[model samples]
Target chain A: MTIAVPTWRNQVSPVLDEAENFTVVEFKGGKQVKSVLINLAGKSQMERIRQLEAIGADVILCGAVSNYYYNLVSARNIKLIPWLRGNVSTVLDAFLSNGLEHKRFIMPGCRRRRRMCRRFGQINKRKE
Target chain B: MAKKRQSTELSDKPRLTNEEVSAILNSIADGVFTVDKDWRITSFNKAAEKITGVPENEAVGEYCCDVFRASICETECALHSTMETGKPVINKAIYIVNSDGEKVPISISTALLKDKDGNIIGGVETFRDLSMVEQLRKELHGKFVFEDIVSKNERMNRIFEILPLIAESDSPVLIEGESGTGKELIATAIHNLSQRRDGTFLRVNCGALPDNLLESELFGYKAGAFTDARKDKPGRFELAGKGTILLDEIGDISPALQVKLLRVLQDGTFEPLGGIKTLKSEARIIASTNRRLSEMVNEGKFRQDLYYRINVVKLEVPPLRERREDIPLLVEHFIGKFNRLKGKDISGIAADVARILINYDYPGNIRELENIIEHAFVLLSGGVISKEYLPDDILHRKSEVTTGAFSNVDDFQKRMILDALRRNNWNRTATAKDLGMHKTTLYRKIRNLGIELPARDGR
Candidate 1:
């Protein structure tokens, strides 16, 4: 599985829309593999998504994302694990160890609601 | 113990206890929080808990960004700057997402905390919940918002009224307007309102590329079609499956490309380059252009049949000058947008600047107004955008503002057309021919520019 984490210093970027760089990790057979960073600075929301599509990230571990981006990411069939924060290595380790669901990595207040774990800080997109 | 405390105090006012300080912090309306040098929350007041929907215990030890989630927390943190520079930030506008995932607009001020010995400690940030104020603004903005587009213009509202009706159908939509009049926005609105909302919305600028490139972009190219084509590449129509494809600047497409587009609209089938088999596209087509397609057709510069094909449902988005009342609202919208983008706390434009904006003729439409505000933001450090912060052309406008109307032409094309009209002895048809434009187009330009034509044709 391939995972893309929008990075800010060592922590996950707080805002997905404004994220400029991503640390893409390639995982295979549940073991450590390859890791690389890609910069998407000055790219629009759609352009960023297009870059992700080209890269083929199986899952995206990210912080807060707006409804505009969340719906688009959901439509693209990419498993989005939003509201995750903390040191990149620690979060990656937690995800690898299957401890990602623990509240330690979840963003503040996301643990309050079950659905918020899926999409926190996003307005529910109107389906009409 | 109270009598003993009174005896200990030498000053006129008695010293308040820690509990009293806590009580004072809890009593006020604005939320207050102090963060240590490590960026961890050291103290979160009761008001902070109430505003954020996070309890004091939950937020006190957490990182400020995680607890606060302000729009600028990660990037342009006010507290971070205050801690670094020792300069306080006052009344910076921002929004934070609360525990319920609702965005709460707030104004925050940050200051450096100090110890009794003057030792540097942490940073204190006080935030005022602006929901009530935002609600007042929303009351003015809400009724006019249609989908993502905001407008109160009667004609635009009429378009907003019939958009759902238009979106429900599978007919090709033609959105005609001046550049920056938001033609593409209208297209997106139509697509989003349609049943194809879930499907990918692809936009291809028909005018931006060569005919061959545009053709390949619109129709999938088969392997071996070109030397670089190692494998078949699906085009926008193929990728837009069950979705909507917006062909922007359709008026600028070549005649040959226009035939292919017409074929797609008519038969919903097209063969890719170097492919014998035909493919069907179920994608809905919405075309937008700054040029007048009707005039293009009359001038024989555009395909008449293609014009009829895409003009099934026409929407003409008026320019900014036509919808002058929307300037203030759009100004507010752009101000809020730029504040978030630039991480500054500009309140709004000055009253005189607002007057200048309202009365000015925006030839470049809404986009020009937005750029003007964005340019002003680049110069302003904080506070409201005033006249001095505006662009030079806007500040030093030619001609006197005697009646709040410009006597001189603002658009360069207006001056060129006037010179052409004079050179052609004021014969409009001859002038249009000389300018390589249709007479009606020239006539419309004259009317739009407020050019007072002489009664005598001078033919």
Candidate 2:
């Protein structure tokens, strides 16, 4: 399963629409296998989603996102886990260990501002 | 002893406390926010919370971009600019994505917050929502706006009125205009308003490429068709797929290619390069040219049949000088565009700059004015653009056109009248229309200017 996260300096990028770097990690047999950083620079709102779609990203972990981008990503059928924060390693470990339900992982200041996004780490496991 | 007493007297004055400052901030209508050097929000006022839909308590201590969600937050944040340049950005129009995920158009101004010791502690930004203003402007100027093309000129408005009818029809459209008079915009508008808007719209510049290259570009080649043909490729005709294709500068194509194009227009079918099977095209055709196709046909340089085929519907765009009224509107439009593009807070042109821009005949039309504004943006970091920021040619042209070139007003008028007469082949009515004057007024001007007539008269 390939999971993508828009990343900054050790943390999730502030907003997905304007985020520059996306880390696509491929997990194999409940362990890590491959990780690649893709640049999402200078892409339009629709083109950004198309880029993720082209990369075969199954689940997208990101921070706050505009409705325009949220709708487009949803239309593309990519599992979007938005409003996430913390150090990349911590978030990844929590995601791997299913520890994201812990309150510390929810993006600060946005606890009361959740949209139609799903609860953290409730992503359905896809068949390999 | 007297100096010490004066210092004591100064210190005794009443001072506003932190609560007073917060109260003052909250009382204002515009959204105001402050961020520390670490890019974390230090304060978010009541208006800021209202505009962003994020509570002040929820916004503070968070990274500003996460709360502000400005379109330029990641690329060229105004607060970042203020912190670096030591210059405030005043009234820069931008949009912020609110908590509800809605993009709210807002104009922001940023300044560096400094302590009493003159050390920069943080940056402050104030913004006002422009959605209502934008909506009102749109409603008030709906007639002058057609798609992205903004013009208050009468001729352009006439074209805008007929564009709906043109879009409804499936016939080939021919748009004739000066190079920068927005022929491509008119074509795109028709395509967007047409039934094929969901399909892709592609354009090919016939004058940009050589004949052989253009032929292959329009009609793709099969594998082994030529030296570079390694695989069968789909050309614009096939890729357009019932959409629309704009053939810009169609007058530039060679007569050989014209026949192939004529066949496509006649029966909507053509064979690809070195391909035996005939392929059909359902793409609607919209052709545009800077040159007159009829004149080219008269000279046998362009095909008569092809000209008639593509000229089923025609649009003629006036030059900048002919549509002189659009200059100020276009200047504002271009300034707003460049503010977002170049990430500057340029408000508008200075009064003298606007005067010069309005009077100068843009030989290159709207595109020239756009380039001029872009050039000004490079020289102007913020605030209104002045005369010095304009290009040298435009500066010189303004003086030459207005004063220096002609000995007197009569000489300039004579020169202009003579040129207009020659342009219309001495036809009084067409010359009058071209000059935006009455026919008799032009005739009287011709008589008073002592302009001589040639033997082969247009009359």
Candidate 3:
């Protein structure tokens, strides 16, 4: 599975729409296979969506995505795990371990801590 | 005796009672709340309860993040920052989803709560709902819009004013215009403003299809109505149930089709090609033709009865040449549109390019101008659309070389005045001052040049 994360200073970007670069990580059998950084700053929203689509990203993990960006990203059939804030590898490890539902990774200010668990359940349901 | 004396001394030092503090918080207009170091709500004021739609009693024990649902909660929590840094954040714009799950715009401020010993204990955040302000801004933005059409032209503005009134009634409307004058757009606008807006809006070009095909396309055909007519097919009129159907190029239909259409307009009833039962049409008919139906009627090319039947309410869309003042507005609109579509940030047309556009009498009207801008967008690399990016015909074609004089002094003068007026944003005084002319002279020149001023009727 190819997972895309908009990154800033080696962490999930504070705001998904303003992200300049994305880390596209390909995982197979719960292990990282390939990781590449893709620059998407100064491009339109549609262009950013296209870049993610080009990489065949199955999921996107990011922070503070607006409704407009959410609709655009979701329309491309990619599962967007928004409101995530943490170091890139740490978050990725948590995701791989299915610990993404824990409160430690909840983006600050989000009211529902368990929403991440629901989002993970949805992603798994889609996979099945 | 020592404990009593100590309590008396502490009381004498000055402290607000809980009631006084609550009164102060409730009196202020802004929503205020305090949270402990662990992010649990410690105090929820009356205003906070009102803004968040959660009562103070209910909100006090809950987590502050859960109550606010603020966008900054996940990224830039001012309260969290204040708690960590022991500093205050003032009046930052943020958004929150209320208990009802509606996004609400708000501005917030945060400060750390400290004891007399200067040790941080908790954080307090104050917020104000911006619903009224945001609503005003939305209404202001809507002031420039009419249906899907945007224009500053007086005639178009007049049409915009009366469109809702026209849409309220169920009557046949005849729209006359040169090709590319947006006849179909007006028809659609009418349909959208009417009560039938939620229903389907269909269009059929009478000129594009032959008489037999047009007949079946408008009235439908039954199964085995003719060879290859195996299944019953519904036409544009049938599909437009309780909605609107735009019959474009109505003048070009054959006489046989015209009579049938006249019956539909007059009686709102028609039968399928081979069906025995007659069906009532709940659709409103809007007929449009670039050719003058009045002239066609006089020339015996079009039926007089049909022309009068469809001409119950007529709208003549002014060609772009007649409404040259809208060119810049239309250009800006198209530039913004194409920027989103093509992912390019072309600012606008260059001065020389604007001059050329204003000078060229657009024979093909607004549609042609849109195509020109689209062409420039394709060729332009960045910044703006200069003369170099324009089509070769627009750049090199001269008046005397192909059609007329390349540099007509009068046309240039008119275009310059129009450009100046637009640059000054139709401020007559500023435009006159910038032009180094008297206001009277400017007004006279505007009159002579036929530049339509912005509508004063609250557009």
The regions of model 2 sitting more than 4 angstroms off are: A1-128, B1-145, B399-459
Candidate 2 C-alpha lDDT tens digits along A17-126 = 78888888889898889898888787655567668888888878777776445645654658676667767768888777766645566554445424422111011111
**Candidate that beats the other on DockQ, 1 or 3, i.e. the better one:** 1
- Model 2: what TM-score? 0.49
DockQ of each: 0.06, 0.06, 0.01
Task: Order the candidates by TM-score, highest first.
Answer: 3, 2, 1
Work out the TM-score per prediction. 0.49, 0.49, 0.51
| Residue pairs in candidate 2 whose N, alpha carbon or C atoms collide under 3 angstroms | none
RMSD of each: 24.1, 24.5, 25.3
Q: Is candidate 1 or candidate 3 better by lDDT?
A: 1
Model 2 in CAPRI terms: which quality? incorrect
Q: Interface RMSD of the predictions, in order shown?
A: 21.8, 25.0, 22.4
The model with the greatest TM-score is 3
Give the Cα error of residue B432 in candidate 3, in Å.
11
lDDT of 2 by residue, B1-459 (tens): 999999788779788898999999999999999999998999989999988888888788988877887878767889999999999999999887675555678999999999867899999999998866765554343312233676646687667657877887999999999899989888888887788888877889999999999999999899999998999998899999999999999999999999999999999999999999999999999999999999999999999999999999999999887876566557756765676555687767664575577678788989899999999888888877778889999988875553223445566557556645643436566566655568898889888988888664546
Q: Chain B TM-score, candidate 3?
A: 0.62
Task: Choose 2 or 3, whichever is better by lDDT.
Answer: 2
lDDT of 1 by residue, B1-459 (tens): 988787567455677998898899999989999988898998888889878877887787889888887888767999999998999999999987665444677999999999867788899999998866765563443311233465656687667657877888989999999999988778877887788888877889988999999999999799999999889998889999999899999988999998998899999999889889899999999999999999999999999999999999999999887776466557866776677666787766664575577667777889899899999889986777778888888776622334334344354356556645643436676566655578899889999888877674434
